[model samples]
Target: MNVLAFFTATVQTTRGLWRIGQTILGIIFRHPIAGTSIIPILSDGRIVLIRRRDDGLWALPGGMVDWGEDIPSTVRRELMEETGLELTKIRRLVGVYSSPDRDPRIHSICVVVEAEVEGKMEVQDALEVIEIQAFAPSSIPQEPMSHDHYRQLQDYLNGLTTLA
Candidate 1:
């Protein structure tokens, strides 16, 4: 009857149908979904991360790529929705992470990028992000990161030092 309940019911029903489609189509096709993650580095060299509401792990700002959206746009959209930071500039492509085991949710190819952000980053949606923080690469949490986020950070850091 209420809006929240109605939304929940709708989402649940949609999820059920989606899973059924996944099962049926997966029998013959291997289409991997696309996702985007952003590493927002500040002027002080600290990177921004969000504490996910579902798992309480501090991870990079990102989400699944929406249909008909380009990777950069997906990155910007997810960053804004999750971190409330507008993407002023995209620095570079960090990498394309496609390890099947990276995320347990589904088969996805995550395009990672380093981006420069403007404005304060508050958790825009409590359902997706619980808290937000910036950390020097050395001080980032070692365990319980949502997916392959820590590995992505290491790759980016390695590239940075080697370039210097």
Candidate 2:
């Protein structure tokens, strides 16, 4: 194989193995973890999503919560870190997505939130985020996405006419 292709395959394999290792470690050492996923909806009724640098799927902007981090604060920090937008006010709890076999790295609970934001959004962290864009709730991308992001988007959209 070409050198570049070989390197890419090697790295992907390593990452795959690392995730499997993490899952096994979780079984031995950790409980179901909690994380946040933020849905940043713009004034025009469009929702924001991030193209992950590693996988290229347009997922909602968010990250894992720190040990003592409040969920709103976690959403704020993650939004700004990934999209350069500050969370103004959390609109509502969009939904909670937790399945027994959702992620390979851990048995995790994802607390999804819908929120308003300030400032223009962009992909700020080059290592983790690749692009940021807004889409009408009806037209979230069809490409591969990170876990239940699409479902979260659907939940947010379905709730737009009422309280979530």
Candidate 3:
């Protein structure tokens, strides 16, 4: 092979090996990440949910807690980012979910909170959120939701504080 072709192959091989090594190291040393999931209740008592762009399924509005940010801040940021709503008040803690399989993308511990929210419902993070809507408690979609959101919502609706 030409010297140029050999050099190109070597560079590509090195890049691929570097990526594989990074992935392995990341998995080995990674800890469970903390995040917040907000069950946003509007003034009229409707629950706000977002359709995830990744799975095209409805899930609670929430995200990973940014470095140096507390749970409340993460809740507020994620709520606004996903649903364009401002937190009026945090009503209650729905649960702390630490199951390794709760999120398919990563092993994340989610702090779920029921919060009173106000503002127009728009998709703030278009890349992550596909659609935003408010549903009556009795009318939440019955089909399986993204991640473990179904269990989270059910626990909230049942007035139970969970720790799992």
* Per-residue accuracy of model 2 over 1-164 as CA lDDT, tens digit each: 99987876776577456545655666888777777899897878788889987767889998767657789888988898789988879988877777866555578788888898878987666667878999887788974688777777777777742222
**lDDT for predicted candidate 2 compared with the true structure:** 0.77
Tens-digit per-residue lDDT, 1-164, candidate 1? 99998886776577457555654554458777778789998878789999997788889999776558798888888898788888989999888888877877667778889998888978876667899998887898787689888888888888842110
**TM-scores of all predicted structures:** 0.79, 0.77, 0.84
Q: For model 3, how does the per-residue alpha-carbon lDDT over 68-105 read when each residue is reduced to its tens digit?
A: 88999988888877888999999999999999988877
| Residue 143 Cα positional deviation in candidate 2, in Å, after optimal superposition | 5.2
For model 1, the superposed segments whose C-alpha errors exceed 4 Å read 1-29, 160-164
**C-alpha lDDT of residue 126 in model 3:** 66
Residue 5: error of model 3 in Å?
Answer: 40
Pitting candidate 1 against candidate 2, the one with the higher lDDT is 1
Clashes of each: 0, 0, 0
Candidate ranking under TM-score, highest first, comes to 3, 1, 2
Which RMSD values do the candidates have, in order? 4.5, 6.8, 9.3
Which stretches of model 3 miss by more than 4 angstroms?
1-28
The TM-score measured for candidate 1 stands at 0.79
